[model samples]
Target chain A: MKLDLYKEHAAEYKAVKKPIFVNAAPAQYLAVDGQGEPGGECFEQCVGALYAMAFTIKMTLKAKGQDYAVSKLEALWYPPDGGADFETAPKSEWRWKLMIRTPDFVGKQDLREAVKALQRRGKNANAGQVTLEKLHEGECVQMLHVGPYEQLCETITAMLAFAEANQRRQHGLHHEVYLSDPRRVPPERLKTLLRQPVRKA
Target chain B: MRDRTRHSYEQRILRVLTHIQQHLDGPLELDALAGLACFSPYHFHRVFTGMIGEGLMEHVRRLRLERAAQRLKQSRRAIADIALEAGYGSHEAFTRAFRERFGAAPSAFRRRHAPLPVPDGRAVHYTPDQVIRFSPKRSSRSMSVAIRTIRPQRVAFVRHVGPYDAVGEAWERLMARAAPMGLLGESCQFIGVCYDDPEITPPERIRYDACIAVSGPIRPRRDLGVQVIAGGDYAVTTHFGPYQRLGRTYARLCGPWAARSGRELRAAPSFEVYLNSPEGTEPGDLLTDIYLPLMPAPGTE
Candidate 1:
């Protein structure tokens, strides 16, 4: 996905802190979680579900002629708490949240309505239940990361370390704005901007 | 004073070049061209050479020969007609110019080159060995757009055959035909859709439409008929420039962007919604919105 328009306007996006709403819809999704030797697929089902919900909301906003500024998307997975029967157990869930800012109130309503519609349609093989939430507005530091999605963890680690050294605490949530959709773009060409909303301690 | 004088000279040279390109088929002389530029014959040669990087005779000869080569590959016009249009008093002179430019005579070149494909459903592959070579750099960021499905459109078009230089006359004819029918309303802008091979169609022979898309019933007229333009998801971009450079913009936005994005290119005819026309604005300052139909990548559905 080569978006000439976005690249041309990237500089404008890096300036200032703007008010934004964060919508996190938990669902079944394919994903890998944790780190190192202990890390494995944490909640694949939940990741798939969240992606479907996010995609649905995106489609609904376009249908209403309301365009939103999508700032970021991030997936968090947590393993099941108790030791239980592995085979018969429901898959541990993951939350895929997308942060978007829109000047139009009608556009936000359109997104809420879309989530309701997805919930009404019922969960299937691809999607799960939908949820929406608003993120508090504040200063956030973001850097454009160019390269493959697999190497994104390194960039995220560097950002976190920078925040820690500067005595800035994580304000709310971790998020990623997809500058390039990897499915259409080559792995080496993918661009995803990592953004962390932060506050002074 | 010097800068102002140089600017005027540059403008005159550009105008002369446009005139020569527009009327390459007819006999053209340096005196006549110098008169158009308002320059004295003695200084005109120097000015033309300095501005255009070629002598007056050499530039005219090159343009005419180039035009003849394009016509031979694109149009079914007789070789003699082409030779005459190229300003050769005899077919033999035209043949010599043609051979000099293409390293082959007119008939032999035509035999070796296939007619450039019309902008029909067939996809034309432009390779490195082809006449034009375009290598574009890929952009980093990709835009996320919500796809919208559009309703089908009904249009009546009058196909204008020949170079875009002569397209203005075809458009005038279309406007005249639409005037009596009250089809020339404020809401409508003249739509020109280019189709066919640029390499094959002599600039005079390229196929275009002097057309307008309408919602109501289309009445019968000369060379006018009801045609359905099926609608789908379209990737649109607006370009501001003279109509001549619109093709280059399309090549950049659609040809390279679509190919790199992995999007499926639909066969629908691309359209230009002429927002500003030569009637209301300067030809160099016109604005046009180009639209190309697109679909999701294969296996995505």
Candidate 2:
């Protein structure tokens, strides 16, 4: 049977309309780092390279009779200057790490081979930009926002207030776990898990 | 043709392993191991984890314990001295760790002359003077794939356009800016956005972002910029273990999984959401969620 990460860690993926706290477990990822607005030329190119490498890896493993369902697209976002509030920062100064989660068994050799494959194909010039990353957000306050992107501000405010009332303070980057396909689903019906790692104030 | 790169890495790792066996009492810093293996310190830990099926420190600690076990069977030295040599501060701590690994206390094991413990597929165990032999593990983990719709998010970020290993300064700068502004909250997520390939792009030209999700409209500053991540459907996978070993997972997804899923690629940047931080977590226990944008099916267009 194929591995489904979402189903395996249902708690992490599951969220509600109201903000709630949960202790997240550890996981791994295929990551690429970049600086710029998310939909710009550089961001587009980076995403393209990232997928190219991801497919190369998938295909190689399939040949060896190992198959898995490729998971979701998640990102960690932050601003350069600490003095600049994350919510208020300009897009030009934004830095982000775009990622795809991979299984635990993937090793460095697999990465080397995939990189070599991409280089040999000479198709994705940015494939080498892909790297592995791991995160273990312990405690977080998360809420599901089922509306357009512009409406997230209100949800975030409520979520932050909820966290504040719970005696927790934001301690890490703001995290989003997208559960809907914006390409297929209308913005009004988009499903996003707005999560924030927190600590006791 | 078979890749020569694998062999080169194996050789480098083997050299380190042999050195570890010989220098059981010496300080084995991560930088020193990376130097010995000719790998960047930033990426070396993962590389070691991938090739060795264990983290560097973990491997070292195991070796030291195994060697101590050998000495217990053969030597008459004080258990305290042996424990000290094994890097434990006290005999009690050594005894606990030893009992956990060998299934008996050191003194009991010495009296019993127990048989060698079963190999955990690594096939490498400590031997006094013999060269360490290694057998690369062939285990591959299965992954689950899901097509998700990501909502556009506004994030504040700092740019680090260089080698992945050198991106620490960017994170430090970002945190330095974030902590003072009360942006360091319980709900914030740390993220990195990669824009270029290290092998193809000049190290100085590679683009990376250190980012945090922000709520409410905030003014953009000279150093920190905010932007919305475009919302779209994406293929995602969750990876468990150290970040360095993600290459294998990427290969699997991009290769067989993509081909089999019958999904076309979307022309957008992929990103990672760190579900947890690394400072307090073990390397093996860290979790990262990876995202890749996907094109809508042909009929939907």
Candidate 3:
């Protein structure tokens, strides 16, 4: 879990918190919450779902001469009260949010155009409503972690403490960049990059 | 027909040389090697010499003696066994060849070349370690990659025997034919596949393929047929140099990096994908991406 993705995409992760308006097509993803412990099973499901959506977007856009950037990705975890063992609970819930930016994000006009093209091909195309949001850019500390997702809590805590002691405030939600495809990589050797945007306090 | 079979004969000789190195202590003769190549001894010697640029017997003799010299200084094997395994009739004959090649007799060489002990008491037995420590570090910290999984390809190939420099003409012919088929493309890198293990393959019989990827299911046309290149995870590194220097880069990346990272190298064929042609760039400026397959080590979490 040595976060090979971050090492490979260091430049992209380093340029965070800058507002970049993006017009992205609608994508389907399995939303997950990050309130509870992030285990191996939870991470595998989350990444697999995200990759499928991203690949579909890339392929769809490439066919239409459009490029998009993954602007924001965050997982909201819902742990039980008192930080109880959610694993033993009857049901665990997670929510995953991804904001992808394309070249045109002014309004629903771009979405209507895409929907029209898909309808012509006789496909169930929902060019969902589009909105423009500010994507903040700034400096951030990142590390590649190779291990079970549950084990990452300790590392994340350490990183947060480091950031706090250094007078840097956490500016945005946390995001994990998937490097090795979970199917190809073993649970033990899976690599994910933990990136948290920060600004000078 | 003889011309068509010549390439196959060369490959057989290289494989035989690899086998000989693995069993250096066993008997190896021209007849035995000819049998392995499925050719008569009369034709075997001629074809081997023509492709490898040395007489078959002479090359084997030199390689065996060279390995003996290394073993003598590196290991505590009895000198008599080393001599016998080198195919020498006596210790005296082995010592003579050792001195001729290495400029020192076996006993004298061993005394002067005893391995140095590190602080942990492990002997530093390999010369490459010392060389790597002194080599300049790469300025860039990035690795190049082409995000594509190439399907299995059938190649019409010619195995080059001996040092790579002597086999340039043969490769030129292979590349010429492959190019017309549109088998070589920008996305598909031209590959030179090395099959023989360096430790065992004699220098005279090292095997290499000058190959390009083909478009479809290959039908054996004339003496050409298809061989599948399996798909898997590969550790890719780009090297900018003449083809002759590729082996050094591979030795550095695979031999050292894989060893240090505690990863096991899979038995898949490691190859160099040529990014630029000799016509487009000078030989020294050619770019080649070297791919080494890797797998997880046993019992590692």
Candidate 4:
């Protein structure tokens, strides 16, 4: 039988409107780096490469014998300095690495192999830039934001407040897992996982 | 000479498998599959049956149903819509076929679907103004990998129908028999075939075949069966070290890489080709090449 990770870890993926503190662990990912504000041509290019490479590698492995559910699209957002206020930072200055979590079986070798295949298929110009990376966000804060992506600052603010009340400070980049497909779902109905790594203030 | 013959055979079959997945939403006919493989329709049927362990139509039907089962659980699309997408012209026909395989009506299965159970407040802590809680851990290892094409071979094997984990007995017996025949050597490869989905099928009914590839003739013993395994396109990787790590290796292959690979999967059982004999080699030094057959990548034949 096929396995659905979302269903298997339903409690973990669940997020209410209210901000909550969560502890996360390290995981591997197929990641492509990009600079500047999101929703641009460059960001789309990175996402295109990541998804295409991901699906290709996925099919390759599935053909082998393993069964797994693909994790949602996620990103790590920050400034080059590693500390910048979302409100004060220039939109053009914002940089992020778009990613999809990969299973452990995939190692550097698979990533290297997928790069040439992806390039031959012309999946994305930036497809060659994708590399395997591991991210670990320890004690953190997260919330579910159900609305337009533009308005996510409201939810982020609420999350920051919760983190502040808990005597925690920002420790890592902002992370999000898109639970809704914006291409089909309305902005008001779109669901996104908003997270920020944190530590004791 | 043998390697070249095997490659050509796998190449022909790869095209047919590709055509099946690409045109599943459309009409799949004997002529089409035969054309894809560049074999006459009559010859194609015989070749497909010999290699796949089932008829061509049967394989297509099973694949369609499996794909439909996945969509029914994943999508909010209507049954009628899904049925049409499954190449069924009517809802009644689709439902009957679905019920026979899944043991429940499509809608009922959907209705029975439940998300993960919620954790209680015991794991959560309360603060002065806001509450503190831990989200479920989201961590898995992953790697980059590529697909491989493999050749079919004739093998001597002992068949065991039961739990997959208990197949060591069958291997022991198979080795005992083949070793006496002087078939044990460095070049002799071992393969393990699990013929059922453990997650969906009952364990008692699962079929496990432990096979040893043999180039020479051996008299058929009552305990062993001989057959030709058709070679085709496969995704290959090695599982290193002990058997316990096999689960993690599978998780790595199936979880992240499959989703990223974007290739369609057929109903073929995955087999492990052992490079080193476990009995003669250290557990940490054991190497097994896992071969998974794949349908051809889309947008190409």
Candidate 2 per-residue lDDT, tens place, B1-301, comes to 1234456656777888888888879987777876897755544554566566665677788889998988888889999989998999999999999999999999999899567676665557787876677865444656688889878887888888887778777876675555434344333567777655453456888788888887655566777788777787877887777888665665455434544455655545667777755643557767777776666765777
Which of the two, 1 or 3, has more lDDT?
1
Q: What is the DockQ of candidate 2?
A: 0.02
Return the DockQ of model 3. Answer: 0.01
TM-score of 4: 0.41
Error of 1 at B30 (Å): 37
Rank by TM-score, highest first. Answer: 4, 2, 3, 1
Please report, in order, the local distance difference test score of every candidate based on alpha carbons: 0.54, 0.73, 0.52, 0.68
TM-score of 1: 0.34
For B10-76, candidate 4 gives per-residue lDDT tens digits of 5666566666766666767776676777654423554455444445666677667766777777789
Question: What proportion of the real contacts between chains A and B does each prediction keep?
Answer: 0.00, 0.00, 0.00, 0.00
Q: TM-scores for all candidates? A: 0.34, 0.40, 0.36, 0.41
The count of backbone overlaps in candidate 2 is 110
Tens-place lDDT per residue, model 1, A1-201, is: 311223434543462222222222222222223321111232334444444444344334433454333323343323234644223334333233333322224344544454454444334233323344444435555666778866766776777677777777767556566655443457787766666767776
- Can you write out model 4's per-residue Cα lDDT over A99-177, one digit (the tens) per residue? 9887777778766666665454342456678899988887779899999998999999999899999999889888998
Cα lDDT of model 3 by residue, A6-73, tens digit = 23344654422222112222322223333222444544444333333333343344334543343233
* lDDT of the structure predicted as candidate 4: 0.68
